[model samples]
Target: MNARKVLLAEFLGTLLLLAIVVGSGIMGERLANGNAAIALLANAAATAGGLYVLIVLFGPISGAHFNPAVTLAMKLRGEALPASLAAMVCVQVAGAVLGVLLAHAMFDIALWQPGDHVRTGVAQWLSEGVATFGLLLTIVLGIRFRERAVPALVASYIFAAYWFTASTSFANPAVTLARSLTQTFAGIRPIDAPAFIAAQLVGAALAVLAARALLPAHSSVRR
Candidate 1:
């Protein structure tokens, strides 16, 4: 694909993913009001459905590395070309910012309250780690194995991660940054979000390194 096309793909893919996360969470919250279970289910459905659509939609154009962490990981293992890394990362992040800015226009949200910090601390951190790992693992296995399971793996991994991880697994960096802008049900406190994003980047990088080590050298080289 052309450079401009790839950049557009990343931009659009990220917006789509962010929209699902923010839009569904907001709608679910308003609908459920006091029902936590309903909210969680709605969030999970949005995550899974969002991923399924994104993977297919952008796979051809940019391989849909909607997260900066994922883009870095792919670049590490050479699965992604290095030439477009900077462009992709910048566009992806910008897309995320745009997505959340738009979300702000759509939602009724408030500025931070003191108690909000407490909710975002432990739960968000742990959830971020698990979500990052799941995302990395899905990419590693699906791409490495040449499995026809890429779509299914991504969807299922994200869905299961929501319940297993406390933070509901906000794995995408673009999503994280975009969310920080909302101050809504899906928002992440800006201060705390960076640390979680760092953890995610570390996890993704490690997974890429481990995946690289697993390949047979000769086979890897023959490509």
Candidate 2:
């Protein structure tokens, strides 16, 4: 595929993904009558469904990697060029910010508010690391063993991660950053995003190493 087309796919995919995440959080919170559990359930369900569709729609064009961590993993695995990695990450972040703004506009909320949701602590950071590690492991293994099931596998894992992880699994750096701009159910405080991001990167790196060990480059599994 052409580079520009690939970049467009990443941008649009990330945009829609964030829109689904933030918009659902806003709607869920408003409708849940202060029941945080119900709001979180709705948010997780919407995000999982949207993510599956987005991956299926964009996979052929751009590999459907909306996360910077995933892009970095691809680069490490030699599946993406360095320039492509940088471009994809840039577009992903830009698209994520625009998505947050789009969600705010749909709900008639202030467009550029900084998030104040306090999601800091060692436990939350550890949760982020584990969540990201599992996510990357799922992607790598699914692609190698069941390429057609990647979308479903990822969506299901994220849905589960939302409930299991303390930080609700903000495993994507772009998502963590963009979400910090919205003070909603899905948002994380800007002050807390850096640690989450750092943990996520570490988790992704570990996953890559684990995947390589589980299935070396010479493995017979289809790439």
Candidate 3:
């Protein structure tokens, strides 16, 4: 893919993802305040469903890797070029900030910070790892089984992981970092953000190895 095209795809994909995540998070928090479990589920469900559709529509254009993990895996598979990877990551992150900024225009996000502080400590770190693992696993396995159906399968897996996983499935590194920038319902504390991003990268890196060594050979996306 061309640099311009790759950048456009990344920007659009991330924008859509952030909108889905931030919007759903706000609604979930509003409805499930004092109900942490339900709130997380609601948000996770929204993210999964929204991503499923968006990835389907955009995957052909840019692989619909709204998450960095997906891009990393695709790159490792030789489906993605390093320049494109950098372009995608950069544009995606910028798009995330724009999405958040756009969201705050319509919604007073600060008022919705229900918790005195965001979730932190080992729980938060583990949540990042768990979320990233599930997300990367779904992407790798989905491609292994049905290359064309990967986008949809990823979306479905994310939706399911939302309720089943402990961390409510905040799997995207860019999303996590971007979330820290806002004080909204979807926000994570700035101090705690880097570890989560690092965890996601590590999870995705391992998934790449797994996809290479374990999955059946498929040249559809070479590595």
Show pairs that collide, candidate 2.
Answer: none
**What is the TM-score of each predicted model, taking all chains together?**
0.87, 0.97, 0.86
Return whichever of 1 and 3 wins on lDDT. Answer: 1
The lDDT of each candidate is: 0.75, 0.94, 0.73
lDDT value, residue 8 of candidate 1: 90
Q: Write candidate 1's Cα lDDT for 84-142 as tens digits.
A: 77888899899877766555456754422211322366566766876787688778777
lDDT-best of 1 and 2: 2
Candidate 1 residue runs with Cα over 4 Å from true position: 107-123, 218-223
Alpha-carbon runs more than 4 Å astray in model 2:
81-83
Off by over 4 Å in 3: 109-117, 218-223
Worst 10 residues of 2 by lDDT: 77-86
Please tell me which predicted candidate would have the highest TM-score against the true structure: 2
User: Against the hidden true structure, what lDDT does model 2 obtain?
Assistant: 0.94
Q: How close is candidate 3 to the true structure, as a TM-score?
A: 0.86
Error of 3 at 145 (Å): 1.8
What would the per-residue lDDT of candidate 3 be over residues 108-190, giving only the tens digit for each residue?
65423322236567776776777787678777776656777776777787777677665556788888767776776677777
Query: What TM-score does candidate 1 get on C-alpha atoms?
Result: 0.87
Task: Summarize candidate 2's per-residue lDDT along 1-223 as a digit string, tens digits.
Answer: 8899999999999999999999999999999999999999999999999999999999999999999999999888877543377899999999999999999999999999999999999999999999999999999999988899999999999999999999999899999999999998999899999999999999999999999889866655754
